[model samples]
Target: MRVIVVGAGEVGTNIAERLQDAHDVVMIDRDRERVESITYDQDVLALEGNGTSLETLEEAGLERADMVIASTDIDETNVVICGAAKAMDDAFTIARIKRTNLLRTWERSEEAFGVDFMVCTDLHAAEAIVDIAGLPGARDVDSFANGLVRMAEFDVKPTSPIAGETVAEADRYESLTFAAILRDDDVVIPEGETVIQPHDAVVVIGSEESVREFAGSLTPAPTLEQANEVVVVGGSEVGYQTARLFEAAGLEPRLLERDPDRARELAERLPQTLVLQSDATDIDFLVREHVDESDIVVAALESDEKNLLVSLLAKRIGVGRTIGVVEYGEYADLFETVGMDVAINPRLVTAEEITRFTREHRTEKLAMLEHDRAEVLEIEVDADSVLCKTRIREVMADLPEGVVIGAVTRDGELITPRGETVLEGGDHVVVFVDTEVLDEVAAAL
Candidate 1:
């Protein structure tokens, strides 16, 4: 597919690189130096001009482009570029809008701009932070296309029943597939004889039913529990956004702010939550609020140091989970080192959303990892496909490299699948294939 990316910042660069493997990508930036850098470094077509200009877009062959992504740091520029592209070809268009108000407008009136998709980075990041804050035990949660399928990463405890079981034995379960094992820093694709060891971070991909079965198979199981009481430190925009998502998810949250007026305003805005006018740095205030009873404490103050300090204090006060929202990317490692359950940078999250919206066709959202460059997608068995009526084991050698069937869904039931499992028409097969080989994998299936 022919694609045009309007921006050369971190987000644009990421989108360009991701699509370059399988599509003809043209990247544009206002900075000549940045354009030259991308052109030489990535071997991609780069043009230096205002992407919002129609002449500049036409010069990049926007008429023949299948997709045009507007991801400039400036929200207005992104909107203009997307609007221009939509007017030009009515092609798939995505815009990265960062302002909270613009997001609200986009949600209420997306059709007016002719945008195929709208990604609000701050909102996505806030949602991710809320998920991690709410469920600290999950190492990672990858929601697939509209949340139909989910891949969760969790550590195998020492007491897990299947700790020593081989891959083939584990696959005997009708549901759940052991996608991949992350041991230390290396990723291992397990085979039949491969054994799972304790402390291994395993990625499990399946439908909700299959995932539940997989989680239950462990001796020391992991369960998603609702937080009876949650506390969020700071009443900033991100903090308010995080609290809103938690409340929508049926969790009770208490928001603490230093200013009484701001607290009152937030209290009115979020009537479902309790708003306290108190400084989060005040240990006495936190203790007085019964922080011990809080299941999760999220530190989302504007200052990174304050967020980190409050998170540590909350952890020390017996809060079951602590999450900190750090704006600076450099502070991410610090939060991880201090044992914060999760730390999110809004810029990175927004960049990822833009990248996903820009890149199309190789994999559906359900097969791709959250914020991952490559994807593992699921494809339904078509009547004319080469994989039909064949046993999985027999066809393994003929399959393209970097692609493997992870699981199969038939008649609304999930299966781990084995070599003897025969491909049947209408089966939804989950295959882990590199983006480069996605077309080959699709053709084979």
Candidate 2:
């Protein structure tokens, strides 16, 4: 597939990197330095030109492109780029937007702005955060097989019951599969005897009920059902959306915004949420309001530094968990390393969603884990698929070391994968693949 990505920002660069291995990728940016940097560092062609210009699109070979993604920082600019691309060719167009109102407008008519698809950054990030909060001890969460199958990543602390247990011993859940173990810098395909170490990120896939049960076994943190006190800091779109989602889940959360007008607006908009006007950095205000009693505190401030500080303060005040909304991709890991429970970057989330959408023809669903070190993919088995009509154990022998069949679904029923299980055509199998062998596995499956 020929893919042309507009705006060489972090989101566009990430999409290009994910697709360059299997497709022809071309990136365009107005910044000369970014174009030059991408030209030298990446395998794809980087063009220095404006994406909204017809001549620049022609120079980037847009007429022959299979897909065009507009990911500029400005929403209007991105929409215009997609519109220009659609006017010139039949290539599928995708736009990255931040406003929910625009997303609603686009939903009424997907072709309204000449965009085939739209990814809302703030809304998706908030949904990701809410998904994490729904599962106890989960750093990341994604659903597959039409919400029948769920994949979750959990950080194994020294205090966890299964911290030192072997994979075989920890495989006690009825329908759960330990997909992979993420050590410090390695994606470890686990065997029966593989020991789970402290601080390792463990990825698991199974039915939603089974996954939730396993999560409870890993930590003593209260489940969302028992979680009574949830606090949201900042009145940013992400924060407002997060609180709104919590309300949808039948929980009334508290939101703190420093600006009086913003707080008033939030209070009027969110009848269930308690909106307070106060600086989150003020220690006295936090303590006086008994913020320490909250079960979860989410920092979604505009500035990454402010979010980091607020997360630290929440953790220091005995909050059970702290989720920080990181603006920059590089700061996400830093926030988690510095004691934040989870750090979500809206741009990265948007990029992953767009990349997955681009690959929908091959895979039913895709989730990138540990910053792209590994991936969990759901693919339907066809007559030509290697997995079709083959026992899983026999298939494993022919495949590489890092592949794990997490779960299989057929005719809307979940099937726990085992060595003796024989996969048939039309089965949607969710497998974990090391990014190193993703292309190979994806081709064979």
Best by TM-score: 2
C-alpha positional error of residue 354 in candidate 1 after TM-score superposition, expressed in Å:
4.2
Cα shift from native, residue 102, model 2 (Å): 1.0
For candidate 1, write residues 303-366 as lDDT tens digits: 9889988988888888877778777767776786776766777766666665555433433444
How far in Å is the alpha carbon of 121 misplaced in model 1?
A: 1.7
**Best candidate according to lDDT:** 2
Error of 2 at 410 (Å): 1.6
Tell me the TM-score of model 1.
Answer: 0.83
The lDDT, on a scale of 0 to 1, for candidate 1 is: 0.74
